[model samples]
Target: MPAGVRVTLRTDSSSLVCRYQADPAPTLNGPGERARIDVVCDGRRADTVKLETHGGDAGFRCEGLPGRMAAPGH
Candidate 1:
């Protein structure tokens, strides 16, 4: 990791966010290898959130949905 090579992602309200420290010597297309720190946040239906990443390999993807909303009462 290098100084000033950090990635940060936040929501419009700035309530939900993520931060990642960049790795200078990153390995791509390898097993158990990561170039960036991975972070996730869920609004749980109360709000909508977006994700972003930086300072790592050019190829990276984040996928998944937030927790399901609770049924009417329980």
Candidate 2:
């Protein structure tokens, strides 16, 4: 797992869904260490995904998000 990561998506839809996997207990560092993934959408933070190394398939839903994906040059 990386220290920090960022992902940006453009959409007009207020409702959004996210599916991800996290390794909260990453063995890459030592025996066991806590790890988590942060989710941010359109400058707005949606949630923080807690993971457990082998943890699989997590879902997140966000509604009423602000902003529309502008088409290049007004």
Candidate 3:
């Protein structure tokens, strides 16, 4: 995927989860790092996700609830 690329999905689900991997990341940390990933539903803030990264090379997950995404002008 290129930078600034937007993706959309159309569905009728009350909740959804997105998971992805970042190759060549950092190692797993002992205490880990604290971060928050926001979930947007219908162009609005729907939920906030708590993330703990053990290392640079790790998996990032994002989730949303009761949201729908489709290609623009669809």
Candidate 3 lDDT, tens digit per residue, 3-74? Answer: 343556566676655555555443445676444556555676667665444444333445455544544555
lDDT of 1 by residue, 1-74 (tens): 33345344443343333444446534456565444433334423333232233555234444353434334432
Candidate 3 lDDT trough over 10 residues, lowest sum: 51-60
Question: Where is model 3 more than 4 Å wrong at Cα?
Answer: 1-7, 26-32, 52-64, 67-74
| Clashing pairs for predicted structure model 1, backbone only | none
Task: Mark the regions of model 1 whose C-alpha exceeds 4 Å error after superposition.
Answer: 3-6, 11-32, 42-57, 67-74
lDDT of 1 at 10: 40
Model 2, 1-74: lDDT tens digits are 56656666667766667766643423356755455556556455656655534355555556655557645532
Could you say which candidate leads in lDDT?
Answer: 2
Question: What is candidate 1's TM-score against the reference?
Answer: 0.26
lDDT of 3 at 27: 42
Error of 3 at 68 (Å): 6.8
**Cα deviation in Å at residue 27, candidate 3?**
7.3
Error of 3 at 74 (Å): 10
**Candidates in descending lDDT order:** 2, 3, 1
Cα lDDT for residue 54, candidate 1: 54
